[model samples]
Target: MNKLNNYKDNEYEYYPICINGQIFNCFSSMSLKDLLLYLNFNLSLVIVEYNKQIIDKEDWSNICLNINDSVEVITITGGG
Candidate 1:
């Protein structure tokens, strides 16, 4: 992996990813689970779509993010 070191000596790889029509820099080494956590998403209340395909919650930790990848986060809401 192409890693970048910051001034603090922290190594990371950032990739441009599109989420819900917005472009954001994402850690290339993070899994969907880590990404969700980093974004402060409530795992129990959201449905995640990766690359246009809905991903199962059980598989979130196994999917690695990539460059130019797309993600959609749909929040579940209940109301009258």
Candidate 2:
């Protein structure tokens, strides 16, 4: 489990999380909605898998992300 710890900056706490196999630093706790907004994802065309489970769009705001949580985001594209 990833735990939040104070960084040298002292102004923020960062937690480590794996998104699509890449490690990212997040400040404080946030919901899936916030994450999507932070990543600039188009909510209407993206699918989110949290901790290996497919999460429904309606539940994004209610789901809180924890340290070390694995998240996979897939963006739908338009093509012929």
Candidate 3:
């Protein structure tokens, strides 16, 4: 058995989430749904807007992340 092997899971790591102009690193190996859950956010209300469009849950996992990807996850919240 070879101890050294390449795996897609190993490629995943914690990265910064750029919102507006700020950077924040939180979770890793998590899909958009997972991320929202971790943040105690409402997935249905929030929008994972990236690359000039909203990314559906089905497409979130397939959304390949790169080093320093200019992404901003906007959550639509209400206030009074």
Candidate 4:
């Protein structure tokens, strides 16, 4: 397991990740949970997708990101 500091210090190059065509680069060493909290996203439920592959949330803490990695975190919004 890489220490949080190990990832925190490196200057990671960012790539834009699109959420419903909204371009935003989420390239960082921060954990997915932290990011979601930062975004203040309604995370009662969320699905993680990386590199067009789906990853289980149970592994979010262990999911270390690399540069250019496209990860999508969609939360359950109020509606039908």
Task: Judging by lDDT against the true structure, name the best candidate.
Answer: 1
Write candidate 4's Cα lDDT for 1-80 as tens digits: 11122123256645344443455556566566655666777666888776688877677677655544566776676787
Best candidate, TM-score: 1
Give Cα-based local distance difference scores for all models. Answer: 0.83, 0.82, 0.56, 0.59
Where model 2 places Cα greater than 4 Å from the true spot, the runs are 1-9
TM-score of model 4 vs. true structure = 0.55
Relative to the true structure, candidate 3 reaches a TM of 0.52
Residue 27, candidate 4: C-alpha displacement in angstroms = 6.7
Question: What's the best-to-worst order under lDDT?
Answer: 1, 2, 4, 3
lDDT of 3 by residue, 1-80 (tens): 11222233455556555544555454455555565567677666767766467788677667654334445567777899
Alpha-carbon TM-score of each model against the true structure: 0.84, 0.83, 0.52, 0.55
Better of 2 and 4 by TM-score: 2
Per-residue lDDT for 1-80 in model 1, tens only? Answer: 23333221267667777778887778778899998999999999999999989999999999988787889999999999
**Can you rank all candidates by TM-score, best first?**
1, 2, 4, 3
Better TM-score candidate (3, 4): 4
lDDT of candidate 4? 0.59
lDDT of 3: 0.56
